[model samples]
Target: MKLKILLFAALCFLSATVIAQTKDSLKTELPQISLSPVPVEVFAGNNGVSFQLIVSKYFKPDSRLGFFNVTQFTGKYDTADQAKNELMSLALISFDIWKGFSLNTGAFIDNYGGFSPTAGIQYLFANKDFLIIALPRFDLARNYNFEAFGLAEYRPMFTKNWGFYIRGQAMYNRNIKQDFLERSYVNLRTGVTYQNFQFGLGYNYDVYGGTFNSNQHSFGVFLRAELF
Candidate 1:
């Protein structure tokens, strides 16, 4: 029941985020989907969707990579606003290089849910007892004209599953044609976890370089569903 509620709330949050946006600013909204949404694009268009193939293989010590190409065919939808029978294609490549230090890179086409290529480096200290991941990330398409760039994640207990984390991020895309279109947010996340998951809330102050439509005291749960 709790899981179901969590899912409902997650969706509600995503929708609320979207509804809060002006018709013009509705592009930057996204649902809190499974960390891993198959690199695929679903669109409402006239063309039918198609698929592409992505391959992944091991490279360096404990490092591996994979890519996915997917296509959608003409289909129906539950929403009236959604396009009918349209084709869309997307590709994603996720790579991780690991040794004492680790690096991850990913890129995608036709951004639907902020799935784009970004680079980050992780450094471990004291026999990998302390760790930190520095990621400057961004999404694409009309959905995310506002690029989100930040450095997030720090594990003080590199070996144990408990520790603290600090994250600072900014969102900005100067191309949007709106008065309060240029915006940025700064927040902090901290907590402990048993594994790769972090349990806590974040507080952020977001603004469009002005005051109107700004957000303060934005809080939400934090989690990471990691595969290897």
Candidate 2:
């Protein structure tokens, strides 16, 4: 009788341990989602409003192969009349093709525009707090234009909940008729963040609207929130 009781207890312990392990593994397989509001100068002058939503899932526990979808809107602030400049949605797959580098290939749709293929590369460092991405593509079928876009960002933490970040992006486009269109735009931003919220100020220069000698400056106030 004593031996039987000991065997029963041991079997129960093993079953419980296996169940816990399975639950943990399932949690790791789930995807992560984040949403934020990223206002821009193009919509409401200095008060333009934009939003972004991202959903990503890793193929394995090590975050090597990942799939993501990003959607964004930019234009004038919310209004009953026309208040939007552009709407963009992208579906991308990112893979750690080599050490310290990753490759991204995706399809993007612009403002009800047809789908356009995109391929880019990311250089990640400093535990992914610092990143540089470049995407240059030609939209020959729909827009008949060649475009190049680049973004650079750096975020360094001072403490657990405090940090600073600097980010910038540039875009250039050219069509058959013109060497470069008036669509060129550049923005530089720096700000302080607490926890998942960021507050900052930035400057935007619109090349299509003015020349460098008479460049137009758009001062912008920005805030971001991380909704998981």
Candidate 3:
């Protein structure tokens, strides 16, 4: 009986996915960019391509802030069709709060670019010698239609200055247009990083107006220079 019930539910889910596979103006209305921390390796081009740098500084043993930057994602195999095509960003941010907790935020602007938020406390843990970390962040951007999601992430190191991670991110917005545009867009992001820079690729599927379904495969990079 349980197996039958599970099968029925699976069938219904598939049907829903099919029904939602159309162009949604609301889903694609807003800019699909924001500041978040990802590793440098995942930002590779369609093939094996990418260029970036990463850096960080410890404000104290438990507090820190930093940034990720990149000029471009250029290669013969790049979709941009230029040797130096790097026009995507996700700035970088780092913070440590009370009791092994911290915050990370950034702005989604250009390749090799990333940013994480700077509000809230974290119950954090590290994997090895500061090479990897885990945390959850709650964010508020003070915009009704741009409410941010609470996220959980895993960052692991591959080299002394290289790393990667997979993050689950979500946000809720009441302003999602239901007629022909969906205002709220949630994403599941996974990518890698080296130094203070990284590249990410993601997928977006939602409904607000008419349903326009699409996937987001992106390459990113950034730089971090603290001046304080």
After superposition, candidate 2 runs with Cα above 4 Å error: 1-47, 53-57, 68-70, 77-84, 120-122, 126-129, 138-140, 176-182, 206-217
TM-score for each of the candidates: 0.36, 0.60, 0.32
Candidate 1 collision pairs: 47-87, 48-87, 49-72, 49-87, 49-88, 50-71, 51-71, 106-117, 107-117, 129-158
Best by lDDT: 2
Note the Cα lDDT for every prediction shown.
0.36, 0.55, 0.38
Candidate 2 C-alpha lDDT tens digits along 50-103: 544544455555665666555656555447525335576667777554433445
Clashes of 1: 10
Error of 3 at 8 (Å): 39
TM-score of 3: 0.32
Range of the 10 consecutive residues with the lowest summed lDDT in candidate 1: 39-48
Which portions of model 3 miss their true places by more than 4 Å? 1-48, 51-56, 60-95, 103-123, 129-213, 216-228
